[model samples]
Target: MTAEIKKQKHVGRWVAVGIVGVIVLALLAAIGWYFVRVNPSVQQVETIETAFPEESLRPEAGEGDGQPVNVLLLGTDARGEGDSLLTDLGDRADTILVAHIPPDRESVQIMSIMRDSWVEIPGHGMAKVNSALAYGGVPLMVQVVEGIIDQRIDHVSIIDFAGFEGLTESMGGVTVNNDIAFSYHGYDYPQGEITIQGEEALIYVRARSPFSDGDYQRVHNQRAFLRGLMTQLMTRENLTNPNRMADILATISPHVATSDTFDLGTVASLGSQLAGIGNSNIQTFTMPTLGTGMEGSQSVVHVNWDGVEEIRAAFDEESMTTFEPPAER
Candidate 1:
């Protein structure tokens, strides 16, 4: 975050925050709709429970860095949803992702760090990266992810899956391309394009048991959902109706936790900056891993340190636009 006001760029794509960006992008692209008046009682953004990692542990950069900036986004499985999670010590972040916006602001790159990927926690020994949330709330989650990328996280936010229920309902539904046919939560998702809304929408993104590849496919589904959501928001139906768009965005506020510095004004500006980034400009991939194995009595994903170095180099050079993710394991 910037030293002056800690204004980290809003992630152009995130399950929770990502959807919000599309909302902003759609609004910004529409006439007289970019300026959203957030109801104080229903603001979708909130300050995290814990402060960021100690300054010493964070990389020195700010809003002025002109360097690529990173935002950490956590998606939970429902335990201690939203701000309540600040005090819910047992809650673990189920989805861990880093959204990188290059200095040019011409494109966005989303890197998903598997929650099960074994990594070093600040004060704890190696363990599932998600465990960092359980150990020290948002602060530790930010610390662990930063350590992996070797960069300071300018801002952090989280959202619970439950929030998507209302969020999806507000949009009528979102459509995504399904690669595998699967029945989940009593709903049959065919191997083709389908529209999902309400409870089924949540079921679609959270269904991993239906895939042999498990979370691997689930993360892919998450990105697909975001892709569809962006299309829905950009539809003339939503962009033309300011009231409808405002209410749809509000449905997610109670379920998201972001830094207090993440205000609507800043969000609008970033939205304006990223207004031109279409789905093609927003790329998604997972951190490289050798494979999964027993890291004791527990199964864990092993990080590909060599691949990580390549990723670090890509970030350093602001060449992520041309970077290719490692082949899936």
Candidate 2:
């Protein structure tokens, strides 16, 4: 009887130990997953360096005075193998934007440079702003934008449109108001308020053929999409969801190229203010330019230097100028 009792106690001890072991293993797995997903920047290594010849644009870093910060946003169309991010696909910058954060950091100014705008390319002569990236990569692209605006860009971020749909789906969907009814790319998007998924939102912004205004209308749509996306990202549910956060990071991780010194947490915190800026408070406009020009047989968009000064003054916070209402298609 004594031996049986001892054996029973030993069995119980082993069972308890097994249960504890399982619980510990589960907890460890969860922690590993959290780190892997949330701290993507930890694994962010600039492993791939393209052989594309580096052109000198002399991209300057932040002024270090804690004044305003300017960041150039580049949307690239590079595609194919070994080029998870944009590469040798003859990719052009489809869209370009400059975000100027004031000294107060309370408000942000977002200015979109028309891709078609012709400008003097540093070391490459005159060409469209988009072509600057294709012709000489990031370095020249930076120089072209800085030359036009007359203010040095502190940093830059390059984004890819390929995984945008996955990002939208992860958010459950995003909604925006359409001021005018228009149809393009086999999608009939009506006027007023409408919800959009990843694919539909892409179509809305990329629809240039159907509108008479062409790229002008497309730029407006891109701004609208960005606003809606920012709002969706800040919502109670999206902000808290670990899965959504992972998906959002995964979507952009491959395409984005930022300065090595950039900090993810700092940007996220600062972005909250920019995101909260109401659509009414924000202004969207394109750099004025002649329709198009030719550079020794290549077509390009001509830049309007006078308009460039107006942009510089606005970014400098020099004077209050009336913001032109966003035009609808």
Candidate with maximal lDDT: 1
Model 2 lDDT, residue 149, Cα: 69
lDDT of 2 by residue, 1-329 (tens): 69999999999999999999999999899757766776774354232343222334443444555566777876666655766454552436677987766666545566778787766776777666777767777666767777776667666776666656656676667787777688876788899878887778778877788777778778778777766776667554655566766667766566566654345655655665454454555556667665665777866666667666766776666322344523322
**Against the true structure, whose TM-score is highest?**
1
The global Cα lDDT (0 to 1) of model 2 is 0.66
Question: What TM-score does each of the candidates earn?
Answer: 0.81, 0.75
> Model 2 Cα displacement at 59 (Å)?
7.9
> Which ten-residue region of model 1 has the weakest summed lDDT?
5-14
TM-score of 2: 0.75
Candidate 2: where are CA atoms >4 Å away? 1-36, 41-65, 234-244, 272-275, 290-299, 318-329
Where does model 1 exceed 4 Å of error?
1-36, 41-44, 62-65, 78-83, 89-91, 231-242
How well does candidate 2 match the true structure, expressed as C-alpha RMSD? 9.2
**For residues 1-329, what per-residue lDDT tens digits would candidate 1 score against the true structure?**
56544333333223568778789887666644334344542454566755588888887665554677688877775544344745563445667788887777767777888878999887889999888877887788888888888887876777777777778888788888888999987899999999999889888888889888888898888877876776566445655455776787678887777876556655545656666456676777789888888977998889999998887877776545666666667
Clashing pairs in 1: 1-154, 14-18, 44-253
